[model samples]
Target: MQEFISYKNIQIAFTAEGKGKTIVLLHGFLESSSIWKHLTLELKKTHRVVTIDLLGHGNTEKLGYIHSMETMAEVVHAVLFHLKIKKFSLIGHSMGGYVALAFAEKFPQQLEKLILLNSSPVADSEERKQNRDRAKRLVKQNKKAFISMAIKNLFTDENRNALRPKINTLVEEATQIPEENIIAAIEGLKNRKDRTKVLQQYKGEKVIISGKNDPVVPFQEIKEIAEQAHSNFIAFEDGHMSYLENREELGEKLITLFS
Candidate 1:
């Protein structure tokens, strides 16, 4: 059943399906637990899957203007704590990966496996931070237009045409996000620190999935993270949305990852 939990006086949404070892799925920026529909259908066949809508996104509510990664991580921890789910695997997409890293740092023993999907542990550089400022400005100026364009740009040139319908759905969801929450999440992401050391010192199995043409994350940096963390890494020729660009391949990799 879909449920809500009170975290820091704000409500966070999550749902659980299937049975056996739990696998938590966290969506990226402008995403909700709904993004896991396709992947969860396959994954739940072998494992219990839980999808969470992070603070300031989806059905969740914002605690304040600043939704820091650490605060988001605490929210995750609280939800799991309430569920009595002491141990489970965690997989995050894009911004979700930042939250996952924060979770790992706070509760190292809780994860059986940690996967970063189209995400990295490095903090934003000066250039990216400046870009984030621009994004926030764009959000304020024209939220709908900015979201539509951003979603379209997430895919590779070749996939863009074929994925038009899906892009519209994503844009619709993104547009539903309140202007304040959008700004909060962007600021939190920009302020997030370098967490590479967390990966380096992590004991559980770690995996990194990257998109070669990802506009936000660099493939080379992802490769370096994998090398440093001594983790398995997968790179696709697609862009930021590898999950959509290569569902079959990414699904297979996730199956192997959970097993």
Candidate 2:
């Protein structure tokens, strides 16, 4: 069911369904909880599924001009706390993964598992930070152009034409996001700290799922992260948007991991 919780005087939107060991899904930057619709339909059958629109995304309101990963994690905690959910397996995609790591650091006892999909625990490298600055400027100048290029770049060249409709849909949804929110998110991601230690110290079930051809987070780095963090690794044969490019495989893998 759809619900909202007041966080810092703003409504934080979320959806919860089914009834079992709770599982919380967090989407990447430029994405909201709605991105998990396809997986939620299946995962809810055996697990209580909850997807929250992180601060500045989906139905949630922006907290401020700088929506840090730590703040986003707090918002997730508020939603679950309001719902009386004590423990849950957390799955985060892209930017969501950064939030998950922050959550793990603050609420280790409450998390049963940490799964990073198409995301890395490493902080923004110098080049990436520069890229983010450029992106923010571009967003302020031509939001539509930035959104179009950003979404398209998520997929490989081979899948671009095949997934044009889906890509367009993503672009459409992202375009609705205000320029400030986009800039806020970019700032958060660019400043996010390296949480490799948190992942390595996490004693619960941990997994890192990545696409072999992911341009955002390199496949080799993720594989090494899995090893360093002692996380079970699952690799898909595609680019970043594995949920769309490797739907069936990802769904099955998630079920097995969450179970």
Candidate 3:
């Protein structure tokens, strides 16, 4: 059922479905709980799946023009705390992965496992920071173009044509995000800290999934980060949108990871 919790005085939105050990899913930037439709439909058959719409996106209220990952993590904690959930595994996609890392750092006792999907624990490199700056400008200059290009680039050349419909839907959804919120999310990501140490010290399982041709999060770099964290790195033939483009295969692996 859909529910809400007042965190920082904003009604944070989330959903809990099915029953069994809990698996919390956090969506990437410009996405919301709806992005997990396919995965949840399958996984909820065996596990109680929880999906959250993090700050600045979806149905959740915007925290501000500068949402730190730390703050987002705490907001997540608030939602789970309200539900009285004691323990769960986390699966985070892109920006959501950043929040998961922060949560793991602050509340390791509640986390059973951590999965980074098309995301990294390292802070933005100089070039990426520059790109985030450019993205901020692009959003102000031409919102539609910015949203279109961002979603289109998440898919690789090999499958863009096949996934045009899905890309179009994402573009439409992203276009609705307040331009300021987009910039805030970008800044939040750009200023995030490197949390690989959390993985290195974690006693639980750590899994990292990356797209071979993802333009945003490079695969080679992700493999090295996973190594430093002592995580099991899984590579997808697709790009950053593997969660959508390769749902069947990724879902099977995620089931195993949660198990």
1 versus 2: better lDDT goes to: 2
Q: Give the TM-score of candidate 3.
A: 0.97
Off by over 4 Å in 3: none
lDDT of 1: 0.91
Taking the tens digit of each residue's C-alpha lDDT, what string does model 1 give over 73-99?
Answer: 999898889889999999999999999
Candidate 1: residue 151 lDDT (0-100): 83
The clash tally of candidate 3 reads: 0
lDDT of 2 at 34: 81
Q: Please write out the lDDT profile of model 3 over residues 155-203, one tens digit for every residue.
A: 8886789978888888899888888888989889889998878767877
Native-referenced Cα lDDT, model 3:
0.88
- Show pairs that collide, candidate 3: none
Query: What value does the lDDT take at residue 46 in candidate 2?
Result: 92
- Can you give the TM-score per candidate against the true fold? 0.98, 0.99, 0.97
Model 2 over residues 10-64: C-alpha lDDT tens digits? 9999999999999999999999888899999999999999999998888899988
C-alpha lDDT values of all predictions: 0.91, 0.93, 0.88
The positional error of residue 206 in candidate 1, measured at the CA in angstroms, is 0.3
The residue-level lDDT of candidate 3 at 184 comes to 89
Question: Of the candidates shown, which would achieve the greatest TM-score relative to the real structure?
Answer: 2
